[model samples]
Target: MPVSDLTAALADVRALLLAPDDLVRAVAAGRRRGVEPPAAERVEVRPVALRAGPHLQLVSRTGPVVSTVNAPLGERAAAAVDDLLAQPFGNFHVETSSQVLQLRVTKRGEAQVHRSATSRRAVQAGPQAHDRTKQRLVDPDDPLFRVLGAGGDKRRQVDAFVRQLAPLAPRALDAAAGRELRAVDLGCGNAYLTFAAHRWLAGRAGEDGAALRTVGVDVRPDVVERSERLAGEAGLAGLSFAVGSIVDADPFDGAAPDVVLALHACDTATDDALARAVRWGSPVVLAAPCCHRDVQRQIAGARAGDGLGGGRGGAGEPLVRHPILRERFADVLTDALRALVLQVLGYRVEVVEFVDSRHTPRNALLRAVRTGGPRPEHLAELDALRAQWGVEPVLARRLAPQLDAVRALA
Candidate 1:
């Protein structure tokens, strides 16, 4: 950019930051000319309220280590933005209370800017962004993409999976933490998520100078063979698949994984995957469960002597009096206990509606990150629920040996 144009951009940035409640978020990223140290490769600025008053947060990211500083919205905030833009950060995205604006720098050092004043908001809420410019790891035309199929819904599912992995990835990339990430996918029918995850990590590794590898395991020999074939055809050397059950499969012949996944694994298979992930001590674990038949059956087992099975005599009997309500209750109760067990196993767990219900009714996604050993409060909640429910969850029963230690601590 010319010196005159550069001056104008900085002036405009300063005015926005100085304005109250006008600047929603501003990000300056993608280094130009690959500058040297302490000058973070990426920086983000946003408005937030502190104990003192309103402040702007400037977060600078240099590889795995990030430095953040809060400056009141004024000259200091403007300087932070100016410093980054001055270094010629190649990308700019500013979202205001009114509209969103974008600026981009070309390889020829020419600035290409665009601004729209329409009062519109982003479709998705969060830091999850899908870069349209970059070549997707799994292109729609590629053989791998064939597994996810043609629908935009399937594509969105893949994109969402990749985007969600971005925030938690830094822990694995920490300079002191291991830079190599090994991921295993259990019950990977067609290995859709397996390939997406490997590609996602591969992209991150390239940007952060790390390493990544993956394995996809399934019991169906044909699907496993197909996945292996696709990996070979796509030249994905770091990814492989084998015909083995989620409960028995050991990826790469027993290599411990840094992340474990079980997307849409059926019935008790989800439990098996979680138990394996816990055993692996994976830094990140995620699952999109397919069915809750096990819990539903257990809940229905409490039938009266006639065995007509109308929610007989359990603590939450009336809850299952209606068939549809029983199904919904089983899903909630099943996931609740699963989250509780994960918490007891030192993981901070969250249950999310990963995909739209239109895609599938069974859309619950379980995301767990290893934090530390079990917390007393979380375990107490689990115990109370279990005692009241009058039935042991499959996961709780399977993980009893581990849960016992956590209970002792509780």
Candidate 2:
């Protein structure tokens, strides 16, 4: 066929796919113009199976003949299909490669996916005054609150941690002090971030200019009592401490917390804090997880040699695994998987280093915001990982029941 004929054929195919009504008219017009409909290639409309898992599938008619198409089914896939169905008439793109006709649905139904208007806005307009003040609160020697401040290297570490979290604080609390904010710091060993959070919230400039509440929680009774005494000595009302593991801290039972802070909640404790915050639907959560031993154990267990073929241990290998390698691998896999789990759970999750290793090697922060419903792919991925590892993660197992609960609330 001539180049012109090829272009016309492509246009007709697109029209047929998009507007079936236009197909007869187009065929009639094509016939009038002496243009023959291209011979149908192998039309195989195999059910669009989701190779990754049962999370998504594409349902559409394929081949040369027209057929009734079913609406996309799975919850997440259906949403994607709905978006495709909402598109106005002329938004799809069709590409032909080899003998395969690839249909890319650009729009569906009544929705038009477009770039966000705010994309052009500057992310950092200026050095926020509130952030500067928050940083000063961690400074051990500031005249306004010298005793409340941190010092030297520790002050720098605290400054870095607070600075990372400042940008994420609820915008409404930006400049306002004492808006009756409630915060719970999990595993608050020395209560560094706990104190900083209280200072920031209580000293925040509210609409009426009032302070808020702050609470620090730890598994150690001594730490809890010490924190309470320190709060009292600082003359900070509404600042208190509680002795409880993050796994059991029920902030939702008493008072809902606006913010939940977890700094270096080792091993599965970070997941505990996250699950707690999700249950309470806390507006903001800042968690810096320390060790990731749960997944590490899973990995080690899965890679172990059994009595099967080639499963025999190599000579001089001590017939056992090295602890250091397992620990390091666990650290990486744990954080990565946790971030993915959070994303799947309908929270916008960001994994970033909260501070330098000099301050703390385990400085990774998983900042997440509750948004849309959970993605099925996330759950599927977690399931697949668990199966592959043949070992369940302590954290994942503990919070498995709550996953659906959190999704429902979202």
lDDT of each: 0.68, 0.53
Q: Model 1 segments beyond 4 Å from truth?
A: 1-149, 175-179, 303-315
Tens digits of lDDT, candidate 1, 101-203: 5555444554545565524332221122222122222454545576445366676677667644544554344321344667889988877678878876775
Model 2 error, position 366 (Å): 1.1
Which pairs of residues clash in candidate 1, taking residues 3 or more apart in a chain or in different chains? none
Please provide TM-scores, in order, for all candidate models, with all chains considered together. Answer: 0.67, 0.58
- TM-score, predicted candidate 2 vs. hidden true structure: 0.58
The parts of candidate 2 lying over 4 Å away from their true place are 1-137, 143-150, 171-179, 205-210, 251-253, 305-322, 404-410
* Prediction 1 TM-score vs. true: 0.67
lDDT of 2: 0.53
Q: How accurate is candidate 1 locally (lDDT)?
A: 0.68
